[model samples]
Target chain A: MNKKIGKHTVRLESKPRIISVTSVVGPKEGEGNLKDYFDIILRDDLNGKESFEKAESDMMYTAVLESIKKARLTEEQIDFLLAGDLLNQLTSSSFAARGMNIPFLGLYGACSTMTESLGVAAMIMDGGFANYVVAATSSHFAAAERQFRYPLEFGNQRPPTAQWTVTGAGAMVLGKEGNYPYITHVTIGKVKDYGINDPNNMGAAMAPAAVSTIYQHFNDTKRTPNYYDLIVTGDLGKYGKEITEKLLKEYGYNIRENYIDCGEEIFDCETQGTNAGGSGCGCSAVVYTGYIYKNMLSGKFKRVLLISTGALLSTTSSLQGESIPGIAHAVSIEYGKIGEKK
Target chain B: MNKKIGKHTVRLESKPRIISVTSVVGPKEGEGNLKDYFDIILRDDLNGKESFEKAESDMMYTAVLESIKKARLTEEQIDFLLAGDLLNQLTSSSFAARGMNIPFLGLYGACSTMTESLGVAAMIMDGGFANYVVAATSSHFAAAERQFRYPLEFGNQRPPTAQWTVTGAGAMVLGKEGNYPYITHVTIGKVKDYGINDPNNMGAAMAPAAVSTIYQHFNDTKRTPNYYDLIVTGDLGKYGKEITEKLLKEYGYNIRENYIDCGEEIFDCETQGTNAGGSGCGCSAVVYTGYIYKNMLSGKFKRVLLISTGALLSTTSSLQGESIPGIAHAVSIEYGKIGEKK
Candidate 1:
């Protein structure tokens, strides 16, 4: 039985294992801090595709296949593919699913899709819906720029608080039986809006949501900041990470000692000219699949809480002067001894 | 346990019950064929909101609240809210979730969102992840028009194959315990594309997917068309309905006698000048909640197969000359005796 924790949290009786993970990144991200951890790095953002959109779909496709291959599982062994991207209609995920031929559930949580997919995949596996499932997400700078902001050709000047959308894709193969780093708990989030309307300052806009979810996760699980080796947030970037920490403090939790943001960790904002940091569905995606998962396997991080945050706003909504609504989902993964039972 | 039967189908042992459902539509849909079945009908599309987008959000808000009220459950009793819309960033669902303060998982399946959400919500309930979950989706004429096609100000001449987007919102509350109309099976879909690129003819684009899912559902469950009193396709409209029948015939399963489309049933295309028919997330949403669900309660239909189809194409992809990929999900609902067990 899946145990229901305090509120908004589910503690699985049979934890789902992260059997295999893979990350693919463009040249910019390849040159970032976690370059060595990425599986494949493209020479350019387009990755030889004619369009950025195609490149994004192709990247997700490659990541899914690569993750399955790394898991030593054939395509037929994977029962479902849950994926999403930062595109209208989730074109990247749908187009990618066209080739894979797996049953697909297209999700849209903007940047938080990584954790959202993971949580759903975990639940599906824990509930015995499937033996194995793949969760993947991707985002591209050019594709996101044209869709959410000015087109690449426009050469519009970005504000200081603006974070560059990462050109990357990440995929994880989750299964009922595997080694360490099992997903133990999941906390789905409620949307929170604090009247922030600036599209460029997404980190600040999404900070409150990250804070809200993290607080809830702690409250639901009766755990504190010291419970995990690290508490990582997805794509809150530098400013948003600071805001989240401040808000968490206000909520009577001090996580600053063992906390980091994937957005800030992915790029050296000062040297990379990425202003605040990287912010996209792929930001936390690649970082987790590449750096975090590998470290967990090596026993460098015994336990971790991964929370991916998203700002739910469209170009039309932003243009119409609506405040950005943010959401975040948290998943707790712990290192277990091989063949150990919970 | 969730039993995997044929290729893409799952037989849920713990069938989730549809406790309550509500539909809200604009004046156009209110004046259509299923007008009497709707819970609330707005006199105007804007619903006194300043913009069509806000109106869309507000419509979803009202439908969700009305459904919860009809379910006789407080907001705190609902475990999760699974929602989606035809908007770019799922603005309506996310905005509504912000106000509802429920844990939300935003999905994007275009028109198929109605069944997609219900299927996931049922799985969540059956999986013991939650006791009660709400599934909701909305679409608006002006909102979808400006986002997908020409703005309302453009006044572009409509093509004969073009279907009018429905201006409506529908919400259903699914719980572990209820009286009747239990969801017994769910079929997740694979993305299928036959090189169709015309976004205006969405029904034609989505017909193949609907046929594929319905065929698989029959094969997996080992039941023919006679198993259900009604086999309904979400919003294939007139042209797509014909295509679906032809495709089903090719598959050697004749469903023409028992088949009806929510799109075609909701509107008199000839008199309403809705071209082929209605096609939007809300087309199937309002039709299911207002017409089919109400009729089922009255025992007009004892068993039904509801398959909602979606043409997965974004404005960016369509502009870039990518073919529209389509998907469909099927759910089996039966009129169970009160307190009956499987």
Candidate 2:
């Protein structure tokens, strides 16, 4: 296969800008300490049977509501809702939107939903289909655990390479051509299956997918890592980040100096013991919306490339003995002033 | 509410287009019989467990592929996939797109996915975000019955007011300002929960919501029902259509004289024992894509307003004894001569 960058003559662009971010991440319910391996929040005033589900729903609701509220758009003013989460029926995103009562567009790309959604949203904004659109995603540690792992009461040991699912929600409001950080470009990933097996070892499963798209992004624009103040990959834990670094070196491209993986930066690896690092759609979301976005808005960083990566394998597929195929999408947000009005 | 028709404000538009339809329905599989209640081609090679689900997945896959084939656009030539379905979690839509490798936008509006999708797709096309955009939706009888009603083997008797879930799929492609019928207008509905209880009586529950939007659409555009060749509403069976007619008459508007409800037109009430009519996302989908579009392309109908209606309630909500809130969105499409090139 040809490995040339920008070899494809097709391109898609977006004109609108993302103005702000608002996030929500609360401590796990019933767990006395906030020092748990995951910094996830629960919605329950107290723990009970449906606490986990409620938490997932509430966290997503709070995150998006806060983002919209902060953007100064009332619920009725929003033109559309773009959201997704890691739930069987997408219960969390749908239930939250149901309460919100805003016309919605539900999406599913696992962890990659944020950029996938943002890409479409930015295009819509640029095309003048909408003025203000909101994109959001959520993940809950307990809910995901019960669904994919063991029951809450089950005392089980996770693999050393297992990554902790982030308990958080992240949201951003993309508005009409504005002065805020305008989204410069978007690049979607192709599924790349490398025969990785352990569900817990998501970093290894998704890292290659991340590297391929990031490399493609750089190649497409003929830009180097230094062009961006920060090059962030969503939820690639310790091992995955190490592998990504090695891959970049092999390609004679070095982003290691400013490269940041949402997983590794979100939690204290040693204290929190998130062996690989924080994972799930929420990891990159909370980190970007909570940490990176605040800094970007404050001028700490002028330009950032957010690559949300995901392993598209489901539990049943994994159980049926299939290797996980991964994907990632890159979205560039630049803090520089937007171009003059049309 | 003050009702005003903006008749002079309505500017008639036209865009010439071509689309292909593929329908899959019923018991015999791989090669079987056309369903009595629906027009999908069937095959006996596929078993019971495989028919509906596979039909759904296959029909949706073929719908897009065929539509794209007819449109003279390759998969890569399409910029985005705007799709939806009547399934738990929208699994059918997502799963089908997974193999196609196109950037996708998934949606759920119960029986109205196709129309809602058209509204969104047209917006994207009109906004220039995409040169070629596709919107498709599906529903499987066995699959829906298992999820929304009793299992197939349960042998539960359905009420006369009950509607059959059509096992079919529909798809369409839109281009930038083409010779085809230009999508002229879109009116999104505000969900109305007027405290209707019976889940089985969906027609009665959804009628008011449908009527409200239809009325609003005419008022917003300042056009009367007589302005279009056809005024179509999705999945409003006999009961719902009657209710809609009554409500419209109360407002001094008579739509029954020229209106056709998808549910009633697709399935025979006496034979199928579907008192009101056929329902499900697939019902309106096959009816519009197969029957309506074919007629429009042949010049039988020039202007049409597809007001696809939906009941936004879920089993959980119904279980919790909450009243079903319904909503509807209308999109106007017109067919005229293809312009000569400059």
Best by DockQ: 1
Predicted structure with the largest lDDT when compared to the true one: 1
Clashing pairs in 1: none
DockQ, each predicted model: 0.78, 0.21
CAPRI-style quality class for the chain A–B interface of candidate 2:
incorrect
Worst 10 residues of 2 chain B by lDDT: B1-10
- Please report how far candidate 1 places residue A307 from its true position, in Å: 0.3
For model 1, the superposed segments whose C-alpha errors exceed 4 Å read A338-342, B338-342
Q: State each model's TM-score restricted to chain B.
A: 0.97, 0.88
The docking quality of candidate 1, as DockQ, is 0.78
User: What's the lDDT for all of these models?
Assistant: 0.91, 0.70
